[model samples]
Target: MVDKPKFNTALHEKDGVNQPESFSASSIANITKLRRKQPTATELVQGILNGNKTALSRAITLVESTNPSHLEKATNVINQCLPHANKSVRIGITGVPGVGKSTFIEAFGKHLTGTGRKVAVLAVDPSSSMSHGSILGDKTRMEELVKDENAYIRPSASGDTLGGVARKTREAIILCEACGFDTIIIETVGVGQSETAVHSMVDFFLLLKIAGAGDELQGIKRGIMEMADLIVINKADGDNIKKAKLAKTEFNRALHLFPAKNSGWQPKVTTCSAINHDGIADVWQIVSEYFEMAKGNHYFNAKRAEQNSYWLTETINEQLKSSFYTREGIAPLLEQYKKAVQNNELSPFAAAQFLLEKYFSK
Candidate 1:
């Protein structure tokens, strides 16, 4: 069993967790004091920039927390890291549950670290809130990778989203890149076909699948399959190796049937066994090949630019809605307006105008 101190030390080095010690009552108190002190966003940003893992983890926690005061700090931290961001490869991994995502990532991360690359994994499973728990368990499953000097694993901070990825996974990516992690892998919360949130934020989107899930071509709903850069058939070892090969062949043929993605990168399908660590290196090679091809075609930079633009527009729209609804006494007015609109006493446009008028009059 990995001792708590060693685990904390490994993660601390990767994330900048300062003053690592055994978790005790004093440790809890110290963290509480830090929270109470509420270091200015600048101090927090400096800590993060200095690669203080504790501070980085705490900053993410603040961003993920429900506390309104922490929102300002979180935004500041992201802004500080923004210019240094977008340099890393953000790969989103998603599949149905039991597709060996966590296992595959552990092996894949090890492979990257071995090749002198720094890897950071953000397991996004915001649906975890409904269960009040993390679904994929990346930290526990990737124990070896977690202990590696060149790897970082951050669990999904709970959020109100169908895909367990937190709303701030984008922000986390920025911070990860700023911390010098070259490969940022995001694992989506798999529950049916709603894992598309990860697709938009990543440079390469990978979909994992088991060999004989009956329907080899499990055309995922919500159009997510159209977004995949690569499809991996995991669990390719054991007596299932031949079946896995067939599955890969089936998926490759299925992929050809679809129109190429808007990015002009044709999705590649391959098979792997995460349990025995088979074909892991080949998987990384495919990702690198995609990068080279996309870079040459000018799709790589274009995709990141597009992602940033979308996030900015979406953030502004969400902020506008939030600011309108959260004002004091706005709840009652909102309720009143809802009923008026429902009863045809007012059109939605008229009701919105009235709300705006009232809000500004105050």
Candidate 2:
């Protein structure tokens, strides 16, 4: 030490003082915790294949991530899981906001799991426009299902468009299937007049409706009704039973108005009280029958193959649109063009053309 002091910098340079550990115990613990939290894609895939819900949730988080790095890892995990998917029955459940879609799904999922099927539910919550924040309350709403070992519930924000949420859901289904969930349920909150995005991904589309005054037959949307393989009138308890039965009959009549579906499966209507768990078994029976018939007639695999093709095109369109809007120098120009169009300085079609040209130029 004395010889090192030959330089004589700042008088006494001493290595005599003892130093504390470079890392505290707490810090080291935290680092370990973080490392455990972020597992590798290979570990995640193995965990998922072994039916570990923790790994499933983590992989799904990666899939829903917007970070470029996370997305690449997500794609890797998805491709690996793709081979294990498609063995499950993907069911889409949608309804008006107040029609108890979550409640119905809970009851229906419980019924399914009771019949020896592993169920995974992907619930899409609407985002607030002002803050773009989601409630993510499906897990809270489905208390029993959340506790069921055989059932898994994942809630996702709908983000800006139904298409975006649907895409994430399609990916989530693959992950869940790879995890050995045989029955997949997708729940959407209040898809206005049409739920075409949800309809395209699921094998069976179940529309839930509640009994209301003059809102049954007169207020139904043709597009959504046409897509439904089964309509279940929920909350048919106490005083609502008669009204729900009437709604079911009206829905059945309305179903006949549309031309036959390509699946050659006639749409059916039933009533159930989700809160009271009445007629829940019947709903599953109908669903099971449809699956049986679909698989028997070879429509089941055909529909799934068709959906795969549809999602391929849908994904390409989504990526291209996202790329254009997120490119450099597009936001300010888009605002300027918006103002110009609003003032009638440029037509919307022309503004769109200009934006496309600018996007391509880069």
Task: State which candidate has the highest TM-score.
Answer: 2
Worst 10 residues of 1 by lDDT: 6-15
lDDT of 1 by residue, 96-146 (tens): 778888899999999999999989999865444456665546788889998
For 245-271, candidate 2 gives per-residue lDDT tens digits of 888888888888899999899999999
The C-alpha stretches of model 1 lying farther than 4 A from their native spots are: 1-35, 126-136, 220-222, 333-362
- The per-residue C-alpha lDDT of model 2 at residue 161 equals 70
Please give the CA lDDT of all the candidate structures.
0.81, 0.88
Model 2: CA > 4 A from native? 1-37, 163-167, 219-221
Native-to-model Cα distance after best TM-score fit, residue 268 in candidate 2, in Å: 0.9
lDDT of 2: 0.88
